[model samples]
Target: MNIDIKADDSPVTRADREVEAHLREMIAATYPDHGIIGEEHGSTGADREYVWILDPIDGTKAFITGRPLFGTLIGLLRDGRPILGVIDHPALNERWIGGLDYPTRFCGAPARTRVCATVENAILAATAPEMFVGKPAFEGLRQRVKLPVWGGDCFNYGLVASGHLDLAVEAGMAIYDYLPLVPVITAAGGVITDWRGQALGLDSGDEVLAAGDPALHQAAVAILKG
Candidate 1:
């Protein structure tokens, strides 16, 4: 699993790759026929009953920059719906795991979102502002809400799930980026969906919005819908 830390100086040391490789090997040996898809390495074994998705280093840019926002994301999907999720940020000394029977935690503490009233009071996050094609819509959203407090890669999603941030919006993301997050956020009593307010499925390809509360989610959706 040795991962070479690229010139970017990200935290992409062998630990990142090794962890995913170890998990892949374990899944393969245990399940024997399960599928695995990873960020560093590609996919293998597709026709199985369960599929494991891995993002060994989710916030590579931040990782390279020596930021502690990167995390190891692992997700298990059954029939294309995530059934289990784990987000580990060792540098931050925090980890979150959720599934059918497992309890969710943040740094070994129970985590939940804070109650937010109108968009004006909510804390919003996004991966990048320029990525949003509907600039006017986004500006409208900003005008109607509290000043966003954070914007970056997977860190935004992590913040939303941990209740540090209220909503996270992003455009131009892949399944691997969003899949592991769906169950984690939802299980934390949050709402995640496309900008259209449609349920975000495994096959979805559009902007994403995840909110700590349903009301905030709906309000964000309406702003994006405009």
Candidate 2:
């Protein structure tokens, strides 16, 4: 597939376009009245009570490099809140399904977050170090953690949901990027919110933080602020 760069300088490939288009078509055909927000295509009736957010390729850079870390993200919002989400790694034959009303599942088995009480004991992951460009103090938090991992994109968040990672933090993310993660993380008994510790929503900003433990979340938020 061919690749093109967007106005924001992010690369968009034909695979991204085709996948999002096909998913949008299915959503439209199945739920004609529902809204859609996609990474490749623009939004349609996004203010509706029921909306689907799609990120056809969450780790495009990794995908282009033939890394299996990329995945497709889909989230369903009801009245502006995420009710369900799915992260599917087609290459790995792995899938995670999560919802506010049910326990998270990885390949149909229950997925639960592990407990960690503080940042000092946490294994933190971020999509990239560039995410903290303007926030120097975040580097200090990174250093304070038990281990600071440097890659994984959306896969990092999924690791947090599955109890394999203690925390995932990022900034300058869009609605489609973070929205799909909310339900998955929360369903696994984790917490996801903005750096300020507020809930995530369609109107939320670019910063995101996910933690397997609430106490770790609180401590991480303070470190993020500094």
Give me the candidate number with maximum TM-score. Answer: 2
Candidate 2 positional error at 137, Å: 3.0
In order of appearance, the predictions have TM-scores of: 0.85, 0.98
Off by over 4 Å in 2: none
The CA lDDT of each predicted structure is: 0.76, 0.92
Model 1 residue runs over 4 Å out of place are 1-19, 101-103, 133-136
Score candidate 1 by lDDT: 0.76
- Predicted candidate 1 versus true structure: per-residue lDDT over 1-226, tens digit per residue: 3346554343466656777788888888898878988866778864456888898888776776678887878888887778788788878877787665554567677667667757989888776666676557777786777777544677676677788898888876667777788777877778888888877656798578888888988888888889
Candidate 1 local lDDT, residue 147: 70
Give me the displacement of residue 206 in model 1, in angstroms: 4.3
Candidate 2 C-alpha lDDT tens digits along 1-226 = 5778888788889899999999999999999999999999989999999999999999898888899999999999999999999999999999889998888999999999999998889999998878789888678788899998889988888899899999999987999999999999999999999998999998999999999999999999998777
The C-alpha RMSD in Å for every predicted model, in order, reads: 3.6, 0.9
